[model samples]
Target: MKKVMLIDCCVRGVHSRTLMLAHRWLAEQERDSQVEHLRLYQLNLAPLSAQEVEQRKDTALGEQFAQADEIVVAAPYWDLSFPSILKVYLEHICIAGTTFHYVEDQAVGLCRAKRLVYVSTAGGYVGQRHLGEEYVQTLCQTLFGIPDFVGIRCEGLDLPGNDPEQLVAMVRFG
Candidate 1:
């Protein structure tokens, strides 16, 4: 069975619209696939201190990324970006000799995942200013060697006179 890693970065947890959309997307995946769900909020994740960076501890999260055949991330847009917790998670997983390694002058990804799907919801219309998705795409494709990248986003949820549920329901994933 294909192993999929679901990284939940939604700060609102069960109340997040992005989480609802992500659940729907995950439900549509192949029935035989195995999903390893990692809830960021539940994890005791701390940013790497200067000393920890030098020590280079092997993390379970990095191992999970290396083992997965595919990845999915769910996060709500916050301050034009995803939550800081997501960034901390990335920092933990993007370890050298785990997710990626240096090849001469270039960095090569060692992760087994071929694709990553990012699901997000925004309070207002971010439009072309969606930096969170762009950052993740670049990281997955260029650094993590996930060639295929997809994003499902629902914008304008907090906009005046907009129904949040209807906006969230518009998200479609294959």
Candidate 2:
């Protein structure tokens, strides 16, 4: 069975439509696998300080990320990107010589996950404004060695003249 790590960054908890979509999608993924749900809201993850960066201490967080066969991130789209807490988690895991390393002026990924799925929701359209999603996708491939990246975004949740519930329900993760 594949080991799945579900990183939930839904700041609004159960009220987050993005998280609702993520859970729905995960439920559909042939459930003969181990799934670990990590709620970022409940974690007291500290930002990477200058001392931490200089120290480059190995972390168990990096090991967890590297060992997962599938990594799913459910982070709500805010300010043209995902929440800041998710970034903090990334700061802790994306470590040098741990999650990745440099070799002869090139970077090599150490993570073992084969796929990365990103889920988000926004009140406005997030087509061209998906800067954060793009960054994460790129990082997954270059920094983490994840080849497949799927991004599912539900927009217009709070927009006028749009049925938020219908939009969410209409989306069938493929």
Candidate 3:
């Protein structure tokens, strides 16, 4: 059985558009695989402090995240980027000799997960602007080295005539 790590960073709980889509995505995956959902908003995850970073050489957070075979991160775009909570979670996971390591001048990933799925919703169009899906994609590929990364984005959510349920259908089945 494959272990999937589901990181839900929706602060709005059930009202979150990204989480709605993510729930459906996870349901589809659950039909075919084993999943362990970890809601970042619900977790008591602490931000990496100066002391934590300095003594992270002995931390176990990275090893915990590395145990997953597939990872699904659901985050909303806030102020053209992900929420601060997700940022803190990333810092905790991106530990040396864990999720990533330094090989000479380059940083490499040590996570066993071969693929990463990023799900997000933005208030406005972020397709070409600095506030869109590209930033998340770049983080997954460049920073995290998750080569197999895919994104499902629904922009302009603040606009009218945008049926979230329909969008969920498209994201889940399309």
Estimate the overall C-alpha local distance difference test score of candidate 2.
Answer: 0.87
Over 4 Å off in model 2, which ranges?
none
lDDT of 3 at 14: 82
Note the Cα lDDT for every prediction shown: 0.88, 0.87, 0.76
In model 2, what is the error at residue 169, expressed in angstroms?
Answer: 1.3
**Tens-digit lDDT track for model 3 on 13-91?**
9899988887777777656677777878776887877888778763455676777888888888888878888878877
Candidate 2 on 1-174: residue-level lDDT in tens?
999999999878888888889888888898698999989889888898899989868888888988898999998888898889988999999888888899888778888888899988889887765987898998987887788999888888989999887888888776
Each candidate structure's TM-score, on Cα atoms with residue i matched to residue i, is 0.95, 0.94, 0.85
Candidate 2 has which clashing residue pairs, if any?
A: none
Model 1 has an lDDT value of 0.88
Q: Give per-residue CA lDDT, model 1, range 1-174, as digits (tens).
A: 999888999878788899998988989888999888899999989999999799777788888888899999998999998999999999998888889989997889999989999989889888776899999999987788889998888888998999998877777664
Which scores higher on lDDT, 1 or 2?
Answer: 1
